[model samples]
Target: MTFVEELREHAELAGAPLPQLSDGRDRYGPVAAILFAQRSFASVRRRSNGTTLVTVWDHRGELAAWGQAPAVDDVVNTLRAWQDGVPLPELCSAVARYLQAGDPAAAIETLWSVLTDDGEPHLHAIVAAASADPTLRALRPWVSHGTLHLLHATDAVHGVRRGLAFHPTDEDAFKVHVYDGPIGPVQDVASAAATAAATAATW
Candidate 1:
């Protein structure tokens, strides 16, 4: 099967639907792109040597950018290498430090990545809070969609399930709304990493 065909079938089977973009024809061949995360575009190009490469484009277009457009460092990486077994959105904002040219901490050029900008200060504060408090020491704090989550510090992927979820509140600067699970309150019995105190116990 062709690279794009296999990719499309696999993505569909995995339940993460990949939407098609413009059928751009570049020097390589007939270029095809998939728009999974907003503004994030990755192309599949099969080289003459039978190697398929995925080029992730970081563009500034009002919509998804063409596969042949200029990128941050114009680095070409294989889909598996670039994805690294993570979701597509990770690639959207993960294009930093390519060749060490741009600021590693600079925000990505996309609306989806920008949505989490409001919680930057809270993210820093939570890190400091977690560093001093031994209870939070074992749990790594992460922010998603402007909400703070504490996950087990297994590895760079924030391995283990997200333990405590904190939502910033307008009531006070230092205050937040803590939830139990990923998107809702923790379960009554099977709610924690160890047991109730880790899960069911209220913050």
Candidate 2:
């Protein structure tokens, strides 16, 4: 069975509706549904050029499954390389330096490689820089500011309490329920960005 067929079978087994497929030559093209849950499945389109694009709520559905997906190790290494012990301004400057060195795409690609890897301290810096930098503004829609803030806040609180385990601290306890879980902010930002970008794209 083709990849498309395999996707269909998986969906069917999961009790999802058979994805509506189309011929690219005449109609539109073979499209797949990504079952996010029992009641919701995202529409993903396969282009004639052999690209599988997953529609993100905001930006045109991203090219999720690239031909040569970078390995997890490569992503980890790239994230490690981007780490510079510095403030957000300095970090943004460093990223700008790389962008000015001739290849903005390479710079952005490196940032992406790091962000998608397991959560790292430097990932926060990268996100902050990318969110503010005009050169990297294209990445704004993808970065979850709310989620990042919550993660950092929670980690800080966890670290403090874990370090001072023998002694109970008011500050640590205060931060316990400071922010919502990872999903709340993530969905909020993604949903808002997706709506805005999709509307603009359609126009």
Candidate 3:
């Protein structure tokens, strides 16, 4: 069966509502179900000027909801296509949002899996944005310090990791190894230090 069909079957088993063109119709529930069944879905809310607010999910049900709804289908469809291409990091990111909205613990777990899977650096980016639990922060040590450090730096550039730390406080106390990239550092230590400090303070 096609992915959409498989998703429909699962939605039926899960008793989720499906998607519909209009909200007033009884079939709307099924349409909602279909949208919810997959890790990603969009809610079209009509507004002034025939626009909509499209809420996209990241696994946790915590939607990175966006406005300007009428054009959302194109965005959502593009994302779905990316998932078919070996699990884009953004898919995991969306799923992370979904989990965070509903169950933070599950979101963290899902984010962790997404990170370790295929060693996708993008997972680090997603986890940085989606999770803020202290326990999850503790797990960062297991990640290569160099990689984490680099991510910490890049996170600064993108403002991704809001409240996480590169290393535990007492810099001298942590015996962490740094991973050197083949090229000259794309990120400077000062920037990374500032980013790490910010993360430590917020999350």
Report, for every candidate in turn, its global Cα lDDT versus the true structure: 0.38, 0.29, 0.35
Residue 99 Cα positional deviation in candidate 1, in Å, after optimal superposition: 14
Q: Give the alpha carbon lDDT tens digit for every residue of 40-76 in model 2.
A: 2223444355444332111222221211213322212
Q: Per the 3 Å backbone cut-off, how many clashing residue pairs does candidate 2 have?
A: 4
**Candidate 2 regions off by >4 Å?**
1-100, 120-137, 140-190, 199-203
Model 3 lDDT per residue over 1-203, tens place: 54344444544454542332223211111122124334444433333454433334445333333323234343344334333442434543553222123343443343344344323343344234323444334332223332343233223223444333344323222212232312222333344344444444444
The per-residue C-alpha lDDT of model 1 at residue 172 equals: 22
**True-structure RMSD, every candidate:** 15.5, 18.7, 15.6
Better of 1 and 2 by TM-score: 1
Query: Which window of 10 residues has the lowest lDDT sum in candidate 1?
Result: 106-115
- The C-alpha local distance difference test score for the whole of candidate 2 amounts to 0.29
Task: Point to the candidate with the largest lDDT.
Answer: 1
Question: Order the candidates by TM-score, highest first — what do you get?
Answer: 1, 3, 2
* Model 1 local distance difference test score: 0.38
Query: What TM-score number comes out for model 2?
Result: 0.20
Question: Model 1, stretches more than 4 Å misplaced?
Answer: 1-119, 153-162, 170-203
Which ten-residue region of model 3 has the weakest summed lDDT?
24-33
Q: How many collisions per candidate?
A: 1, 4, 31
Candidate 1 lDDT score at position 34 = 39
